[model samples]
Target chain A: MVELKVDQDKCLGCGNCVVACPVNGSISPETAGGHGPKTEDVIMMVENGVIKLFNEDKCTRCGTCPLFCPTDAIFLE
Target chain B: MVTNTKEVKGKDICVQRISPEEKRELAYKDDVCIGCGICAKICPTEAIELGEIGAIERTGVDESKISIDEAKCVLCGMCSSACPVDALDLKLDEKSIKDMAEYPQLIKSAEISDDLCIYCKACETACPRDAITIARILPERSKLVTGEIEIDKDTCISCGICEEMCPADAIEMEHHEPTSSDPTVSSDITVNKDKCVYCLICRKSCPVDAIKAVCRSCSYGDYDLNPEDSETTGSSFIDEEACVNCGWCQEICPVDAATVEKAFEGELTIDQDTCEACGACVEICPCNVLSFPEAEFGEQSDKVQADETYCIYCGACENVCPVEAIDVKRTAVKHTPTKSKSWEKQLSELKT
Candidate 1:
């Protein structure tokens, strides 16, 4: 298991991580098609202006979200 | 059976379509893609679409700006070739057609030669897109200059004059209040060695001659260090994804290290009859080609001047002018040729 943390200051909310996450892709095709998730049952989604984590159980600890982050806002431990 | 798959690796997103006869792949980069919508506009199959760019940029939210429809896409590579930032890639049978001679390739490019570059950082300042970044390491200041400072405790009356007068804030005085029985005050002064630039301001300001200081670099004719030991060295890099081929770097570079090929060939003209000389176009021009001539004899200039040599022909001036006085005619767009009628139609739209 890994911990996911998004630095609010650094994050630009570009949604690069939302498209990159395998769990998000599995949950809905809208995310895989390069759009934000329409369903709520996902690991993370863009809310208000920044990304917010929802279903932590869906995360496979893939650690791909941090790699795609342009501003280094996401950290997995 | 046909299968479609997707994968994200770092900044790159790759989508693959496989069948019995052929295998095709398309890749997009998050960092390189500026969400300019050029690919979406040029897509022959209408497979690419753009999201709300203005809302996403203003809010700084996690929202995708570009999306592709796999079913509608034919993997023709039109969108990949039309992208200004080179953010898209299409491959066939494990080989990129862009590398092949049969396909037309965009001749536009930007390059910087390391051997010829002196690291002057002129290009970094001139780039309108902020695409160039230079990192330089200069000689250490302490090695070049040597200094010493001292303060006498007995002579220092704790008047706090030197501490107040210090420009570098290097001096500090700690004061102890006198007891009722004993009416004498006691204090200690300290000079931070690292913070002190040895300007001798505190020493000169001392009323009781309490401070002594010396700077050796001012008097010494020559130091023992070699000239080569203090040489400046560093690297400079241009962000290919961010560069717009504006030719500003090439124009400002003194060493001829930077080279650029522009994306458009065009002419811009201002109608004298309609122009009010509000200087709207001058403020909007990103390439700094347009400017209002200086007023003479305390009279405001009635017209704006333009230097066409640096103009990238981006049509920003035409869009910004409120009076409809400016006309920008794009004679040609620098892109790979295409046989598709839709691509030709899209290319025609850019010329006007």
Candidate 2:
């Protein structure tokens, strides 16, 4: 099983990963529209300017979240 | 013989006047111009004409906000020197007079350090004029790792254990009634293909052996890659002509990467006695310095608050206020020392 790891120091809380995840778009249309998801049911979200992993079960393991990260903070290991 | 030429090249509008003794060129950047019409007003020959600024701004049409008459323009550089945003650039014989120290320059500058920048894009979001731009590049995901997962629905008991144990939120449990009040409590579980990261957490946590997951990279040969190849990298650029030196980028940058020297120093005040508290200034403020206090009872008060930390003193808020309660007093303007009498007069007019 691959592990999802986030380095807090490298994270700028940019929300790039959250918006890039397709699962987040399915959970909330706002994410697809390029804004943060308003609901709490998504795979990940930016909380207090930092990203927080919520429902990991909903992730398709598409590797999209880490692909769009500008800081390389989020990654699958 | 004398010759004149005009060329509009990708937002860089240029008008040239050539003579045997000297060559003069005036360049205007359509993207950098704020449509303030200051050039039109200051043009000595009245060659500059402003377009429908209000309509252009409303419709967001891709059109230049100002037009210049090539034949009438004398290329004196008056409008260029007078322009606040440096949208107009006048060059004499390949070099500008400002560069040669014959003309004064604005004492304003902006710097963004690539070393300190984290590419959070806060500056881009906070910039009042959309002057800051950010671009980011990341590694390809497929090249990094691969995995697969499958659920045996027939053998699955639908106990909701996998749903609870899943780290990716990829599982869901649904109940199916058997028509009668059957004690079996028939139920099933469905896996969301989009969310399943094949983490195997649900597979290990399940009481029954129903989930099968595999990490190809782990079992097979790991992808040969360097750590730096997986690194994210990008840069941010600020348009010199579009940036007003407002310090929004400096103030919003989380890493202290952006720095700006403001053009004008001033005090903005709203007279409470005359102010209707219509929040017009708050809506019109470009720097986001003015905002109404949060109402507790779902009803707003007649007071507005101002955060003066990043204010550039542009006078936009004052102009938009209908009650005439807002006052913007410019005490100083940042400009290089000048010898021109008319420029000094204009500079004096700014210092109220």
Candidate 3:
């Protein structure tokens, strides 16, 4: 299992990672049907200029979030 | 024994030394000095001290008394050159430094011109070194911090990326000497995620296969359920790694989701000489934004006028044209509906 960390101070709230995430876990169940699987678990969320991790367990460790982060705020261990 | 005596004569101040040989020295003239403090502020040796007099005199009035220590003065004339009022009469024969001529060797950093700045954070994002810090002033107390952008000179590499990204032309690469070829022509493709409706047309139209629309399908936690009885759900995602930044998606997007910035140097142009005026583009246009003048009997070609505001830049007209005369360097695409009979009817019905 990969450990994912988000530096809250560094997040610019650009939402690029949310758009780039291939997994449906980040999206809400209501909006997930059209794009991906409808799941109760959500991996990531953005609010108030910061990206928050909702369900770290649901993350697939695809390493897409850290790559797309413009500020390089997210890290994978 | 030699004693130095200073005497003020009208606007001119003369310093005289009383010894066997009397030497006369002329300092700054007070008549032309507006007391702007540019000289005192730019002084490297801190030789000039300007004293404030009153509240009314704080703003541009020359009520502040300026005392210059002759020992500390480097005679660099930087203060004299920076003075906006031309009050500092440092007899140094040199022209005012036009935008830091010697700054490349003397100073290595990026500087912002407050007067030309609009507080845009394009430079902040563009800086690879993360040296620039922009403190946004609150709406109510904006006057307190008009110019709040600070650049850490030590971390800055003087790469000039900030200068290129500055939309208002505010950031200056002080270390780089101004040259004819200094202005960078930056062309970037951008996406406004809010306007995107997830219409997959752009992904399908991408020539490089740069855009990937991955639709994930899964059954609701029922692995044992029969295939026919299970419900499948799906979502779209764009792969940034695969994207070549060709801006084809920007042209094909139905909404104003994607944009290509040309920075006013119009790259899109219709060649008048080669255009056959078959009206194929004008006819095929979905938005009715393209129109050409009615040709005379012998004329085979006429200029096509594109209403930029209404254009979605779908490239449908460009794809359908037979002559390939239209050359559109797709800069931007926007979804603006034209009011037709059907639209009016729909609007009227909705009003009720």
**What's each prediction's TM-score?**
0.56, 0.53, 0.19
Worst 10 residues of 3 chain B by lDDT: B53-62
Worst 10 residues of 2 chain B by lDDT: B52-61
DockQ score of each predicted structure, in the order shown: 0.01, 0.01, 0.01
Error of 1 at A51 (Å): 40
Which order, best to worst by TM-score? 1, 2, 3
Instruction: Quote the lDDT for B217 in model 3.
Output: 23
Model 3 lDDT, residue B166, Cα: 41
- For model 1, give the interface RMSD: 20.6
Model 1: pairs clashing at backbone N, Cα or C within 3 Å = A13-B61, A13-B62, A15-B62
Superposition TM-score, candidate 2 onto the true structure:
0.53
The candidate that wins on TM-score is 1
**Residue by residue across B136-171, what tens digits does model 2's lDDT show?**
786655455557778887778777788888876878
Q: Which portions of model 2 miss their true places by more than 4 Å?
A: A1-77, B1-20, B23-31, B35-75, B93-100, B138-199, B204-207, B210-232, B272-285, B291-293, B298-305, B320-323, B339-342
